[model samples]
Target: MKNKFLLLTWLLAVPLLWGGCDKPLFKTDEASIAQPDELPPITTTGEGTFACKINGVNWQRCGGGFLQSSIIGEWHPVYKIFSLQGLRSCEGFDDAVYINAFIDSIGLYPLEAGQYDDFNLECQDVLDQYFLLETADNWVEILNLNTDEFIVSGTFQCTLVHEGCGDTLFITDGRFDYDWAN
Candidate 1:
């Protein structure tokens, strides 16, 4: 009778032990920078001397950054195209999607511990809300995964409901290119 009780206790404890622990994390592998010879063709459309402005003031250049990624297996230029919907100048935006341009200031954030895959980028809006965009999604399809430049050509709109300002929509369209700064 004692043996039966002990066996029952052990069986219950075994499951609890297994279920309580989180999954073990794995390290991501590293990818090398693509050689100039193997580098993918860069899109010449909208290239050279591009600029942007926010609230009628000149802002930073749209593209000119680089990121290193093991997944991409090369030093990829952080370039992509994005489209915006429902945006207007001097209007309070509430519910709209906008195509916001972005540049990869830093290399991709690691999906694993200490792994830097150039597939991730830190993007922000005119308001400076940080959006950590990743290339693992459909972005890989829009931008040539083999080249440092990829294009994200789609309509994105944002609908914002500001309590004080009511609501507004913002949208834009453009291409982004990236270069290594540091």
Candidate 2:
């Protein structure tokens, strides 16, 4: 009777221990970036949508916005700024991408519509915070930029170098259309 009880206890505990040891399905590799070749090509139709390929995997923004900020205190009338951001999600993970553009005389900020050798594009993910300004290998192009209607659109391709792990994420076919609130 005692031996049977011990055997039954071991059987139940073994499965529980094994199940608790399960690892995450999406793992970040230190030596190489994660690449998913099966993802479909990003849409480039400019239909007021945002999509991008991050590390070769499809990432689409569920929501995004354009915001403005102004320097207060002594510089109240001297400085006003605008910023654009998008949030991309995959497998419960969210990546936030941001762009800060140059402000105009009329307090309107729009992305520069042209190929840029360097820019201030930034991205933050679970693994790392990546930046385009760290290396000269990254580039961005603004296909369309309009501030009159409070809309800004663009396409970009960049190699975001991780700040902590030294890993790299290749972002390609990146496009966005941000409509700011009045």
Candidate 3:
């Protein structure tokens, strides 16, 4: 008698407890407007963030899956080269910006090709347009680099000249924080 009573109570109570709700438990505002792009917070503790404004529009890295990186940084001790690359792709459009600084110390480097060190910004835009660094008016600054942790943080702004047409690409408010070891 006791087992039968408990079984009946369990079945009756379970249905009433689970099926009593007539409305959703959580609500998301369907009429809510999308927010504008905001830059990620600058960090140096291996947050793997990279962002910049291209032609006054905000952009950030995206691609993430097996053995891939949206933001990556590396420092070669032998050659003393620092490399950083960021990639974003969506809606059949793609963009990439990268820098290879051949400097031994942390500082600002002009966007120029010189005998000792080379600093260049190679940007590929949405229409597969090619832009290369030309003039020295643009620059990149190495703000902080933690060699022990493989984290690098920096700021950059550059003007790249188009290859096909004689146009210019302005990259501003650029910042990156990456940990290659992670």
Q: Which prediction has the highest TM-score against the true structure?
A: 3
Clashing pairs in 3: none
Listed in order, each prediction's TM-score against the native is 0.21, 0.54, 0.64
List residue ranges in candidate 3 displaced over 4 A: 1-36, 66-69, 112-129
- Candidate 3 clashes: the total is 0
Per-residue CA lDDT of candidate 2, range 20-65, in tens? Answer: 7655334543225443444334333334455566666665544334
* Per-residue accuracy of model 1 over 1-182 as CA lDDT, tens digit each: 99999999999998788776674233222123211222122343322222222212222222223221101111334453222222211111111122233423322222210111111222323443322233322121123222334322121112222222332212112222322121
Residues 29-140, candidate 3, lDDT per residue (tens digit)? 3224232379787776777787787778676765465234366557887887777777654322244677667655678876432111011122333454444566446676
Model 1, poorest ten-residue lDDT window?
112-121
TM-score of 1: 0.21
Ranking by TM-score: 3, 2, 1
For candidate 1, the per-residue lDDT at 51 reads: 20
lDDT against the true structure, per candidate, is 0.26, 0.47, 0.63
Compared with the true structure, model 2 gives a TM-score of 0.54
With a 3 Å backbone cut-off (N, CA, C), the pairs that clash in candidate 2 are none
